[model samples]
Target chain A: MNIKVLFFGILEEIASTHEIIFSDIHDIKALEKILNNQFPDLTRYKYLISVNHEIVKNNALLKDKDEIALLPPFAGG
Target chain B: MNSKFLVSGAIQLEIVTKSIASHSNKLNIGAHSVFLGQVRNDVINRKKVRAIDYSCYQEMADKQFQKIKDMIFNKYNDLTCMHIKHSVGQVKAGEISLFVFVSSGHRIQAFKACEETVNLIKDEVPIWGKELFDDNTYNWKENK
Candidate 1:
C-alpha cells in the first residue's frame, strides 16, 4: 500500500517535504523503522505520528488514502 | 454551524471571513474573542530574534487544527463561530504569526474558547519555526 508521509522541523531539513511511496509495510511501526534507517537524525528528536489527522500509536494500521504526518514537538507560543 | 476555518503554509495573514456582513449580524453572537500571536525579537540567552522561518508538516498541522475545532465545538455550548490562521515561511518580529477568533453568545465562553484553542495549537500543532538571530545565525526550536 502507498501512504503519504510528512516531515517537519529538523526532520524536514533532513527529509524534503513530500510523500514517499512504500510498497510493502505491515504497519506504521515498519514504516518508522524504514524511515529511521534512512534518516537516523530523526530518531534523536521527539516526534508524533498522525494517521489521517488522528494521533496514533506506532502499531496503527494504515489505509490507502490515509495521510500520515510526522510532527516534531512544537516550541511556539 | 457557520464558521470560517483555514489551514495553510503561506506567509500572508488576512482577516478570514466567509461573508463580511456576517459580523454585523448580532442575532446569534453576543461576544467575540480575538487572539493574535506576534513574533518576538528575543529568545533564551539574550539572543535577539531577527526573523522566524516557519514550516510545518502541512498534512498533520491541518489535521491537528481540525481536531482542535472539533474538540471546541463538542465542548462549548454557545459558540457560534471559530477561525484559526498560521503563518509559514519567514515572519519578522512584531508581525502576527497566528490568529484565533471565536464568537459565542457570551463573553466568557468566547474568551475561554479562544484561549484554549491558541494553547492547543501551540502545544499540539506540528508546525515548526526557526529563529534567526541578528548575527546571521539560526536555531531551530525543539518541539516540546
Candidate 2:
C-alpha cells in the first residue's frame, strides 16, 4: 500500500519538502513510527493528524492513496 | 458557499469601503459589524519585525471556512450576510491582513457573530504566518 503524507507550516521546513510518499504503511501508528525514525525533528513539535482532510484524534487505518496531513497550530485571524 | 477568501498581499482600504457602500441596498440589515486584523510590529529575538508572509493549506482552509459559515448561519438565523477576506502573501507591519464583515437585523447579533467568527478563524483555519524581521531572520508566529 502507498500513502501520501503532507507537511504544512513549519513542518514543511523540518521535513524539507511539502509532501512525501511512503510504502507498506498500514495504519496511523505505523506511519507515525516511520516518520519518527526518518524525521526525528518532527517529534519535537505539536500538531494534529488529518486523514483525507478530516482531523483524526487517534490512530486510523490507512489504505492505498490515503492523503495524510500534519497540521501545526493555526495562526489565522 | 462562497469559497474565494484568500486575497493577495494587504487588503486595500478601498475594498472595505466598497463592500460597505454596496450593502446600502440591503435595507433589512440594521447593524454592520466589521473586524480588521492588522500586522503588528514586534521585536522578536532582538530584531524588529518587517513583514508577515502568510501561507495556508488552501483546500482544507476553504472547506473549514465553509463549515464555519454553516455553523454561524445556523446559530444566528437573523444574520443577513457575512464576508471574509484574508491575506495570502507578504503584508508589511501596520497593514491590514484580515477583513471580516457581518450584517444582521440587530446590533447584538452582529457583534456576537463577528467576534465568534474571528475566533473560529483563528482557532480552526489551516493558516500560518512567518514573521520576517529587519535583519532578515524569520520566525513562525504563534496565536495566543
Candidate 3:
C-alpha cells in the first residue's frame, strides 16, 4: 500500500515539500507515526488529518494509493 | 470555476456587482447582509505585512462549503440566497480577501445568517493563510 501524504501551512514549510509518498501504511495512526519520525518539527503544532478528502479520526483505515492530507488549524474568514 | 465559493487571486468588485445583478429578478428577497474581510497591514516586530498567500485543501473545502450551505439553509427559514468568495494565492494588504453575502425576506434573518455563515466558515473550512511580510519573510496566520 502506498499513501500520498500532503503537507499544508506551517507543516509544508517544515517538511519542505507539498506532498510525499510512503510505500507501506496500514492505517492513519501508522502514517502519523512515520510522518512524525520523518518531520519531527511537525510534532510541535496541532493538526488535522484528511483521508481521501474527508477529515478522519485516529482509527480511520487506509487504502492503497490513498491521498492523505495533514492540515494545520484553519484561518479562513 | 464550477464551485460557488471562489479561490482566486483577489475577489473583484465586478464579481460582487454581477452577483447582485443576478439576484435582481428574485423579488422575494428583501434584505441582504454582506461581510467583506480585508487583509490588514499589521506591523509585527517592525515587519509590516505586505500581503497574504492563501491555500486550502480544495476538494474538502468545496465539500465543506456545500455542507455549510445546506446547514445554513435548513437553519434559516427565510434565507433566499447566499454567496461566498475567498481569495487564494497572493492578495495585497487592504484588498478584499473574503466576501460573504446572505439574503432573506427580513433584515434580521439576513444579518443573523450572514454572521453565522462567516463564523462557521472561519471555524470549519480547511483554508490557511500565510502572511508575507515586507522584509521578504513570512509566517502562517493562526485563527484567533
Q: Pick the candidate with the highest lDDT.
A: 2
Candidates, ranked, lDDT: 2, 3, 1
**Candidate 2 TM-score to native:** 0.96
Between candidates 1 and 2, which one is better according to lDDT?
2
TM-score evaluated only on chain B, model 3: 0.95
DockQ ranking of the models: 2, 3, 1
Better of 1 and 3 by TM-score: 3
* Model 2 CAPRI quality: high
- Docking quality category of candidate 1 according to DockQ thresholds: medium
* Runs with alpha carbons beyond 4 Å of true place in candidate 2: B1-3
Per-residue lDDT over A1-77 for candidate 2, one digit per residue giving the tens place of the 0 to 100 score = 89999999999999999999998999999999999999999999999998888899998999999999999999886
Model 3 per-residue lDDT tens digits across residues B47-136: 899999999888888889888989999999999999889887899998999999898999999999999999999998899988999778
What is the C-alpha local distance difference test score of each model? Answer: 0.76, 0.92, 0.88
Write one digit per residue (lDDT tens) for candidate 2, span B7-78. 889999897789889999999999999999999998887888889999988888888888887899999999
Residue B17 deviation, candidate 1, in Å?
Answer: 11
Error of 3 at A26 (Å): 0.8
Would you list the clashing residue pairs of candidate 1? A73-B143
Q: Pull out the clashing pairs in model 3.
A: none
Q: To one decimal, what is the Cα RMSD in angstroms of model 1 from the true structure?
A: 3.9
TM-score of chain B taken alone, every candidate: 0.84, 0.96, 0.95
